[model samples]
Target: MDNNAILNVAHLNIKFGGIIALKDINFHVPRASITALIGPNGAGKTTVFNCLTGFYKGGPGSKLTLSSKNKSNNLVEMLGEGFKLQDFINPPAFVKRIYFKMFGGTHLVCRAGLARTFQNNRLFEEMSVVENLLVAQHMSLEKSLLKGVFQTKDYLESQERALDKAHDWLKFFKLDKRANDIAGELPYGEQKRLEIARAMCTSPELLCLDEPAAGLNPAESAELSELIIRLRDEHRISVLIIEHDMHLVMKIADHIVVLNYGEVLFDGTPAEVRNSSKVIDAYLGKE
Candidate 1:
């Protein structure tokens, strides 16, 4: 691992039955820098995010190591190399298993200081904006169920802190005025920003965004590009974005990686990628 690397992915492979999704993927997100993954549709970009978040477990030998606050976690290691449907026969055991998978699954990755947003806006539709943000901090907030149930000072302080953090992000995203509104009532662009804000409330070392610019207009995309840069420069958070918008990618990403057919097609800085003939050929549908 590089001294400044926050996330490292090596020997990553994912296959859906007979179909190859990602093959031997290797990359790293630099500390406090924005890295963009760009490729044509179905280039397996989102698959990488899915693998990183534990939604899709890659085959054996695949590894994703996240470094945060001087601690490192190998996501693949936390998830053992086995899947047993038999362990879920009993209802009580199955509920426990499901909770374990939910809490220790992506929560393990998130607790390791990584957070992610989906391609589609994933805000809690029925909850208020601030409430949605608060829910994202469930792991840290409810660390002590007894304290919360008794309404102890520590729990109240923690709740206040969580609410403060949520408001801070809402202010940053210019959604403070809408903090009391239902998340689904917001405009599509605002919902996208709210999702990112919710992720930020988790205080991740690295934030992974899957096509954040997907449904936004050009102006909104430009705002998102600026916000992403600010997240790296001001907040000191690393970002790994999977985006098809070349304009936004060039504007925000310090490093760019292009994938095609489950393989790395090109890896370079934004300027280098812009000048690479191979990248041009790949985008142009050439060999």
Candidate 2:
């Protein structure tokens, strides 16, 4: 584990029955930096993101470790796989592991201080824009059903904070004016911003963005690059991004990891990646 890293992936391997999606994938996202994951069309970049975010489980010996605020979580281990021998000795640990295995999903990943946007905008189509942001904050809100129903002072306070935070993100993303509009009706660029804002509402220590600038024009991609830098420089959030836009990636990434066919081909600074013969041959191409 890199002490400077917010997340570390090691010996990661995932197979779909007979087909292996990823094999021995390893990388670390340094804290308060932008790290870009780039690869060819079938390089298994999204598969890595899915495993890191708990959408898919890695095979045996896979370790997805996340460190936040001085605490560490082995995401794969948290999935409640069969109890270990050490767990048998600790009855409490056994019970806890079992509970997570039965009830755990992607929510647990969010709770662990990681948030992400999909390759495609996944806004709540029928919901209002603000509603979309609010929903993303649900896990962090007070969950006392009784207190919520009664709207106790604590509950009310929490709700107020959530709303304020939502609006703050909206303003940051310059979407405040469209707060009341239906999310699905927004233009493509605005929808992209809204989705990133919604992910920010989670107050994550690490943010993962998948193809965020996919449909954006050159100007929009440039703006998105600046926003991503702000998220790291101003907000101190670590970022892991998968993007095909080399210009955006090279401009903003503090570090780069190149994947080719589910394997790490290179891991270095942006300049190193640009100069690497293997990367050029595998993905970047001769230029």
Candidate 3:
């Protein structure tokens, strides 16, 4: 792995009941840059995301490595032998049949500094808008369960830090005015912004977004683009975005990776992707 690469996906393959969704796909996302993943429907774009984020385990001989720029930790090796779906399901402990294999998936991935947002908004509908951001920052809290139970000084400090961080994000997204409003009660555009702010609260070195512009109107999409650019420029966080909006992708992406039939068809600058015959053929079909 090169020192410059923040994430490396090598020979990733995914299958479901003999249906191969991704075939030997490979790519690298560099640090402090915005990379775009674009493809037509059913091109395995989302499947690639699933593999990278640990939602789906890759097939045999597949590998994914992630490294951070500022940290000495080897996230690639720390991920510990790819993902296993069985590990994500927890069985009854009293039955004496509990399997550790069914209990240890990739929650560690997020802890290792990668975070993502889903294609659809996944907010806590009942929680206040500010609470959504606070929940995401739970990992950074300084207090332990024991400290909270005993009402220790650490618990008070952690509570204050969490609230301050939450307020910062709300203000950053211009949602401070609606901090107490329920997440579901906000307008659709505000909900989308809230999701981004929530992901930011995780303080990930690398952030992955799935079609953030899907349901947004042009104005909303423009705002979304600005927010993403702000993330890259102000926070110095690298981003991998899977989007179908060409205008948004072109405007914000420093590099573009195009996929067709679960394979890389083009990888270059946005202008290069726009001009490539292969990209046009994959998206528009031969004339």
Using TM-score as the yardstick, the better of models 1 and 3 is 1
Q: List the pairs of residues colliding in candidate 1.
A: none
lDDT of 1 at 134: 94
lDDT of all predictions: 0.87, 0.92, 0.83
Pairs of residues at least 3 apart in sequence or in different chains that clash in candidate 3:
none
Q: Rank the candidates by TM-score, best first.
A: 2, 1, 3
lDDT of 1 by residue, 12-78 (tens): 9999999999999988888999999999889899999999998889887887888886888878755
- Candidate 2: worst-modelled 10 consecutive residues by lDDT: 76-85
What lDDT tens digits, residue by residue, belong to model 3 across residues 27-72? 8898889999999999999998877777777778777777863564
Task: Provide the lDDT at 198 for model 3.
Answer: 93
Instruction: Write candidate 2's Cα lDDT for 156-213 as tens digits.
Output: 9989999999999998888999999999999999999999999999889999999999
Give the C-alpha miss distance for residue 226 in model 2, angstroms.
0.5
Lowest-scoring 10 consecutive residues by lDDT in candidate 1? Answer: 77-86
